[model samples]
Target chain A: MSLLVVGSVAFDDLETPFGRRERALGGSATYFSLSASRFHPVRIVAVVGEDFGPDQMRVFEGRPIDLAGLSKVKGLSFHWKGAYGYDLNEAKTLATDLNVFADFKPDLPANYRECDYLFLGNIDPVLQLDVVRQMARRPKWIALDTMNYWIRGSRPALDAVLKEVDILLVNDAEVRELTQEYSLIKAYKKVRALGPSTLVVKRGEYGVALFTPDGIFAAPAYPLENVFDPTGAGDTFAGGFLGYLAWIERTDVTALKHATLVGSVMASFTVEQFSTERLEQISQDEVRNRLALFSDMIRVEDL
Target chain B: MSLLVVGSVAFDDLETPFGRRERALGGSATYFSLSASRFHPVRIVAVVGEDFGPDQMRVFEGRPIDLAGLSKVKGLSFHWKGAYGYDLNEAKTLATDLNVFADFKPDLPANYRECDYLFLGNIDPVLQLDVVRQMARRPKWIALDTMNYWIRGSRPALDAVLKEVDILLVNDAEVRELTQEYSLIKAYKKVRALGPSTLVVKRGEYGVALFTPDGIFAAPAYPLENVFDPTGAGDTFAGGFLGYLAWIERTDVTALKHATLVGSVMASFTVEQFSTERLEQISQDEVRNRLALFSDMIRVEDL
Candidate 1:
C-alpha cells in the first residue's frame, strides 16, 4: 500500500530544559515520513531547498519511502528556532525563516495522487485542501493534523478542510481552543460536528484519545523516564496512525482505535531523543513490546 | 475478605463554577467505604458527631458494609467549606470545623483488626500509623493517602508511616512537594526509595500512574462532560483500587495495573454529581459499562 504526506521539510533549532540542539533535521513531513515508512511505502509531497542535504535525505533513504514528490527550490529550507519553558508542552518561537517554503506550492507526483492514504501535516489549511483537490482519485482515508496558529489565523480555511478530511488530529489545548469547551468530551462532540467522523485529541505526556459518534476510546502516552526533546512527537503520532490504517486497509471505528495506539507507540520513540535520533533505531520488537505495555497500562478487571 | 478504612466523615459546603451545594455528605472515609463496599465488605473506622444523621448513614446502610467501627461523638460532625476556582482541580478552604473528628482516635473492632486490606485516607499521618499499630495482624497490603499539609506539618509522622505501608497514593503536586522532585517519574522513584513497593501519582484531571519496582503503568482520567464536584474523587479512586485487589487477593504488578483502571472507573462516577450523589445511584451495570468503555478507550492494534 502507498501513503502520501504533504507538509514542510525543514531544519529546526530547539531548546528544552534538558539542553539545546542546533540545526536539527526536523519538520512534520520529515517525522511523518520516517515513522510511516516503517509500516508501508510512503510518497512524500513536500518542498525543501538546496540546503536540505544528504544527511537529512539519508534519514529516509533506506526506508520504504519514495521522495520523488519532494521538490527542491533554490533557497534555504523552512527554518524554525524555538524554546520550551518549564511547561515543555508549550513552545515559544524565537525565529522563522520560511525562505522557499513560504511561497512554495505542493505538486503531487502521478504515483502519489493514487495513494491509498493521505496525511496532511500541520500547514496552511487552504493548501491542505488544495492537495486533496489535486488527487486523481480520492484516497481511502484522509487524516489531517492542525495547530492553534491555523485555528486562530485561518478558521474558515481550517473548518472547510475539516469537512473534507476523514479524521482530525490535534493536541488537547488546540481541541479546547477550537471548541471553546473545557470538557474534552464536549470539545470532541463539537469537533465531530464540524466534519470528521474520527477526532484524536493528543495530550502530550498524558496520551491520546479517539472519539467517534459510536463512543470515545483513549490510550495513555507510554511512560518515558526522560524526554530529551518533544519535537516531531505529534507528527510521528499522525504517521503511525495513518500508516497503520494503510497497512491494515481499514479506517473503521475499530481500526481507528487501533491506529491511536499505533500513534502512541510511535510517539513514545520520538520523544526519547532530540529530533528522530532514537526513532531511527527503533526495532519491531520495541514497538510491539510498547504496544503490549500500552495494553497493560489501561487494562481494567471485573471487580 | 474484609477491608478497613480509617478517615474523616464530614458535611461539606462547596461552591464551583457549576453552582453551589450546601452541607453535602462528603469526606474521605465516606467515599472510600462506598466504593470499596462494591468489591468486598468494608469496615469503616471513623468519627461523626450528633449532627450526623440516619439519612447520611443510609448511604451505606444496605450495602455489604459494616458501620460498627463508626463512632458518634456528642458535638457536631466535622464541617468543611471550600470553593473551587475555574480550574476546579484546586480548592481553597474557607472554613474548617474539625468538630468530632478533631480528636479522632480509631478503635478497631476485633474482626476489623484482622482485615487483610487497609486504606488510610487523608488525615493526620501520626494517627494513621497508630491505626496500623492497632491492627491484630500485619495486613497483607496497606495503602496510605496524604495531602501537602502532612508533608509540611507532620513530616516525621509521614516518613514513619511511609516506611511501613505497601503503597502510597498522592496527587502529582503533593508527590513533587513531598520528594522535592519536579519530575513525576523521579518523584515516584524517590517515594519508592522511602520503602513502599508501589507509589501512585494522581493527576486530578489527567489521571493516575502506578510505579512499582517491577514496572510502571498509567491510566488517563475518564473524560466527563460535566464535573459537578471533584470532592473525594481521589479517595473514591483508592477505594476502587484497593477493593479490586482485596477481592481478587492479589498485590502483584498485574494487580497494580488493574487497580489503576478500577480507580479510574470509580473516580468517573465520583465527579458526576455533588459528593456521593451519583455514586449512591451507581449500579453494577454502570461500573461494568464504564470498565468496558475504558477497555475500548485504550484498545490499539500492533503496527
Candidate 2:
C-alpha cells in the first residue's frame, strides 16, 4: 500500500542535556517519512527551501521515498529552535521561523494522488482539508494530526478535516485540550462523535493509548536510561503507527494493538538522538528485538 | 502465609469533584488491611484513639484481619482534611491533626511477631525499623513503603530500614525524590544499591512499574470514566501487591508481574468512591474479573 504525508520540511536548532545540533534536518513530514519508510514506501508532499541541499537529500538516499511533491521555493526553509531540560517529556520552543512555510500550499503530484494511506501532519486545518479535497479519490485510510494551535484558533476548519479522517493521532495533552475533557475515555468519546473512530493518544515518555469502538489498548514506552532529544518523537510515532497499518493492510483490534506497539518502538528510537539521527541508522532487526522486549515488559500471564 | 502491617489508622474529611465524605475511615493501614484482607489474613499493628467506635470497627468485621494490636490511646485519632480538583492525580491537604498518632508506638502482638510476610507501611522510619527488629524471626519476605517527609527528614533511619527490606513500594515522585534522580531507570538503579532487591514504582493513573533483579515489568491502570477520589490508591496498591505475593508465596518475575496487575486492579476499585466504601463492598469475583480485564488490556501477542 502506498503512503502519503503532507506537512512541514524544516531545519531545526536543538539544545538538550546531552548535546546540541544546529540546522538539523527536521519537520513533521521528514520524521514521519523516515519512520514510515522503514515499513512501507512513503511519499512526501511538503515544501522545502533552497537551503535544503544534497547533504540533506542524502539522508533519504536509497530509501523508498518519493520527493516529486517536495517543492523548493526561493525563501529560507521552516526553522525552529527548541531546548529540553532533564525532564525530556516537554520541549521549550524558543523560536519558529516559518519563512517559506508561512505561505506554503501543499500540491501533491499526480502519482501521489491515489496513495492508499494518507497522513495529514500538523498544519493549518484549512490546508489539511484542501489536501484531502485534492486527492484523486479518498484514500483507504486517512489519519490526521493536529495541535493546540489549530484546536483553539481554527475549530471549524479542524472539525471540517476531522470529519474526513478515519484515524486521529494527538498527544495526551492535545486530546484533552481539544475535547476540553480531562478523562481520556470521555475525550475519546467526544472525538468519536466528531468523526475519527480511532484515536491514538501519544504520551511522550509514558507511552501511547489507543481508543477504538472495540476497547482500549495502552502501550508503555521503552524504559531508557538516557533520552538525548525528543524533538520529533510524536511525528515518528505517527509514522510508525500508520506505516505498520499500511504494511499489514488491516484495521482490526489486533492489528491496531500491534501498530500501537510498533509506534512506541519507533518513537523510542527517535528520542535517542537529535532529529532523525537514530531513526536513519536503526536496523529492522533492532526494531523487532525492541518490540519483543517491550512485549515482555507489558505481558501478563497466569501461573 | 500470615501478613503483618504497621502504619497509621485515621479519620478523614475529604472533598472531591464528585462529592465529599466527613469523618470517613482512612489511613495507610486502614486501606492496606482492607485491601490485603481480601486475599489473605492480615494483622494490623497501629494506634487509634478513644473516639474509635463500633461502627468504625465494623469496616474490618468479618474480614480475615487481626485487630488485636490496635491500641486505643487517650487522645483523639489522627484526622486529615483534604480536597481534590478535576485532576484527580494529586490531593490538596487542608489540615492534618496527628493527635494520637504523634505519640504512637507500634507494639506487635505475640502471634503477629512470627507472620511469614511483613509489610511496613508509611510511618516513621524509626518505628518501621523498630517493628522489623521486634520480629521473632526474619519473615519470609519484608516490604516497606515510605513517603517524602521521611525521605527528606529521616535519611539515616530510612536507609537503615531499607537495608533489611526485600521489596520497596513508593510512588513515582517519591522514588525520584528519594534518589534525587529524574530518570526512573537511574532512580531504580540507585535504589537497588540501597538493599531492596525489588522496587515497585507506583504511578497513579498511569500504572505500576516493577524493577527487580531479573528485569522490569510495567502495567497500565484500568481506564475509568469516573474517578471519585484517589486518596489511598497507593496504599491500596501496596496491600494488593503484598497480599497477592502472600497468597502465592512466590517472588519470581512472573509472580511479581501478576502481582503488579492485581495491585492495579485493587487500586482501581479504591478510587471509584471515597474512603473504603468501594473496597468494603467489592466481591472477590469482581476483583478477579477486573484482573482478567486488565490482563487483556496490556497483553501483547502476534496476529
TM-score, structure 2 vs. true: 0.98
Tell me the tens digit of each residue's lDDT in model 2 across A150-181.
99999999999999998999987899999998
Per-residue CA lDDT of candidate 2, range B1-303, in tens?
789989989999999989999999999999999999888899999899999999999999999989999999898999999999888877899999999999988888788889888889899999999999999999998999999999999999999999999899998789999999877899899998998989998888888889998988887788988789998999999899889999988878999988888888999999989999999999989998988887887776763
- Number of clashes recorded per candidate: 3, 0
| DockQ, all candidates in order | 0.46, 0.68
CAPRI class assigned to model 1? acceptable
Q: What Cα-based lDDT does every candidate model obtain?
A: 0.87, 0.90
Runs with alpha carbons beyond 4 Å of true place in candidate 1? A292-303, B74-76, B85-87, B97-100, B109-111, B180-186, B252-255, B296-303
Which residue pairs of candidate 2 clash? none
lDDT of 1 by residue, B1-303 (tens): 679899999999999888888989999999998998888888999999999998998898889888899999899999999999867889999999998988899888887889889998999999999999998889988999999999999999999988989899998778879998756778888888886888998888888888888877777788899988898899999999999989988877877877888888998899888889998999999999988787666554443
Clashing pairs in 1: A207-A221, A217-B297, A218-B297
lDDT of 2: 0.90
